[model samples]
Target: MSITSAERRSKDAIKARIKKIVQKRQSRRRCKLSDEELVLLALANSSDQWLMTAQIGEFAMSNSFFQKQAAQFLFGRTSLHASPQGIGSLPSRIESYLRTYGIPVHSKVDDENNKVYSMTAGAAYALLEGSYKKRSKATEKKLTTCPLLEIPIEIRMKIYHLVLKVSGFRLLVGTQSLSVYDDKITTWESRSQDALKMPPLNNFLALLSVNKQVYNEAMPEFYHENHFQFRDMGSMKNFLHNIGSERRKHMRNVSVSYYNLSAAAAGARLLAESDTLQKLTLTISATKDPAGHFTVNSSRRRFSSLTQIPGFSSMKRLRGVQQLVFNPRLEHDVVDAFLRPIITAPKPSKLSRKKKSNKRKRKHSELMSNHEAGQPAVKVSKIG
Candidate 1:
């Protein structure tokens, strides 16, 4: 029997609602059952919590899901297996998706192997929060997934602290170039690349210079461990002048190796005023004593002796000094001269002592009068 026009319209509306509901459910499942789900599934199947990627892959191959455009690929090879394709391409595809969400996948070099994929805390959050559907389709530009760019500055700083906790202190020392968040491109050659290569620290600093947000976030990281490796005098002077007005609090650790006494002096001057500098490692390459004068060989002012500079006497400005390592070959006298202010006892404050004595006398007289009169007197003392 043929259906009536009104009945057909009613049927179509019901079918549409059902389809929408199904789509929503599938999307939720896809988001919830991530590659991490593969591990759970593996445990259920083999009663083993620790299994290799290969084992997980084998388990994914056994559990089949009917194809739907609702992000089924997230649970490993379901989407790929559904297509009219072989399973060989599944590893690379999974790797790509994992990387897009900032997951760390282990790999070996020489033989060029991308190994088991593991989730970072950031990646796990990204996976949970990531939307599977294409929201804006007008332009196909690469989408930025970093929450750092989207969140408010206050929240971003908290997030940065979280990132630091996850990445650790060694992160600053690992590489200067590798950014915490960056775009990914799929190239034929790079698809098989063993390790991801990033720009040098200088290049990363240059990138930070381009935008205010990047500059604000990156400046501390850029100067966290300042290093001035100089080959000549001109570059050394220029570097010192450039960083003269910069906030010294960020210069926590500094390393300077200079070619001559002048360069070393310039470096020393820059570091002397650094209020927050805690650890300093200095290496002087010049044979001449630090006290020796370098003539005005160039247009810049040449100092006859570094001992005359106020900055040399003001090394105590770095009140947070913890570790000081100097090259053994460096002159003890020169190092001593630089470090004397830090090591020597501070001069007694005549003004402070006089004021304290007057106050003490007044207190003593008050206390004697209080004792004779049977009244209470208060005492003040400094607490360390």
Candidate 2:
């Protein structure tokens, strides 16, 4: 029957907030609107509903500010002598006033040739008293949101580095999921670890779950930069099977201690698939002799222990590894045996080729110099 007091109060509150904003901004205008006219305009624009010129003009005409030429006021004319080019700028100026409070509006023409306006989803119009701080806090984000997809991939990768990269980070991979190993934690745990024990979780892995784009960009940063270590070659082989090829493609460095023949070989075979691998380091950390019939020194199990592992055929599969280093503790012959497969007949790099060319030129110069001096070139001997 009659408007409820709650409805009346809400109407008063919206009108008051809009009135204050419109009045304050319109105060600087050459032609200012009266309180009734401003309140009417503010209420008409407060909701997202469209307001045509005729409808808005009725409100203006009801007030003393506009008895005639309501159309001129609806158009851009701020004063009677305002330029014709100013048409449409008045509504935009009003919209600008609303924009200052984070409520923005957009306009379109209806079938009746009436220009109507509605709010854009782009704003959080928090005009109530307590809501000012909340809206103000979000203003910067609203202005600065450059979508993650829009960012250049190179810059995005650097950003990924900030979130995901860990310097000197060594992840201990297992048969399934694995824990991280700090430098303080040596790789000497018992072989039969409980599978139930949760592998320590890495926070950076959260980047993968953010979205597909971030996951794609972040994968290389986390996997490529960090060195992966294995307790034994056996675990590495199992991990190689389970580590998604997409992720494994980014891996750079890997180190595994020799504990089993079949595992070392099988893992090496799997590792050869990665063209991105830069280095492979094998450590001979086995304290006891393996179950092989090698006729080497019986007392020194460590040295002979390495040479006996028959994974050499599998070790050669690592064509992707730029450098293959063996733990210094192993005998040189043993290291060389494993090294031959991974780095045998290594492709010469530019620097090595340059060095070889320089060596030839130097030898030629020395030979010519010796000949000119009528002295036999002293035979150069390399003392091993």
Candidate 3:
């Protein structure tokens, strides 16, 4: 069965030439195709076809050039073959290619009751760029139907401000620790304990929780336009702390009631530091002395402490405090004594000035009279 040496050499030479010819053909085919051309060719052949992973492998196997190019495009590899077993269970690269061309592949039952894949008419048209026109028309219809989005943003914000205005004077009340005598429930607890059960209702404030955009638009109006009332400085401090620093910037008008010197000082310090505070209305409720009488001296001392607080003393340092209104108005003398030193221009003491002026006039008249009567005028020196 052994062949001659010359015959064997001749057969080996023929095999080498065949191999060279095949390689040349493959190289030529690869050079002829671009990425876009390969994609277009694959899509055109599979248009409106529900191709499974196995079916796509068959198509790749038929064309050696396509298989090599497809593997490069899909998996970024050059040596892989386009066969059912070679592609494995999931052809992710192939699926991506199909999806990029707008081919919608869905699974369905074939006539033999086996699951098979199919493409929709939309996918077929998408290959030819017909679907883009349809999508553009649908988008235009949606934009035209929604008239609210079409209005100018500036005008929309104005409408939001008007609609979100607080209905009445906004009074922010805090829970005092007291016994509840209600028929339904009786307990000695802070109102904050029941805060979870009964939440305070502010219709205007409800707008803040709607969504991000609405909250942003409505919050500034809510804080700046409405007057906020707090029972005491403590309650106001707590509210401010809870709202955090960012939101506290919008608060313009604040009303608080003070019952003691410490409370007034604390409240003054807080308001002094606020960047956007325009008006502060302080209602000083008269506190009783040990004798149980509302003492003027005690009220005066408390008001004095407020002006002396380090934060409140430097009024010029505050950015935007234009007005300070006191309720149950204090006497003019009391205001001039304590508040005017901090808030207003210092006027010379009227009584002292008047006394000095009168004394000068009397001395001048005495000198004139003495000179006219031919008596030597004696000057009286001031003695301590």
TM-score of each: 0.33, 0.42, 0.38
Off by over 4 Å in 1: 1-147, 152-198, 206-210, 225-228, 231-234, 247-249, 262-267, 285-311, 314-317, 337-384
* Candidate 2 C-alpha lDDT tens digits along 97-212: 65675544567899988667654211222333234345456766665663876889888888888777555446676545565555333334423333333324556577677666
Give the worst 10-residue stretch by lDDT in candidate 2: 120-129
Using lDDT, give the best candidate's number. 2
Q: Which candidate should be chosen as best, given TM-score against the real structure? A: 2
Q: Write the per-residue lDDT of candidate 1 for residues 160-191, one digit (tens) a residue.
A: 44432222121112123332221132111222
Model 3, position 214: C-alpha lDDT score? 66
Provide the RMSD of all predictions against the true structure, rounded to 1 decimal. 20.6, 19.2, 19.8
lDDT of 1 at 225: 42
User: Which regions of candidate 3 fall more than 4 Å away from where they truly are?
Assistant: 1-150, 175-202, 260-266, 285-320, 329-337, 340-384
How well is each residue in 276-310 modelled by candidate 3, as lDDT tens digits?
Answer: 77776655434444643343324444323334433
Structural RMSD, model 3: 19.8
The candidates, ranked best first by TM-score, are 2, 3, 1
Q: What is the lDDT of residue 296 in candidate 1?
A: 24
- The local distance difference test score of model 1 is 0.46
lDDT of each: 0.46, 0.59, 0.54
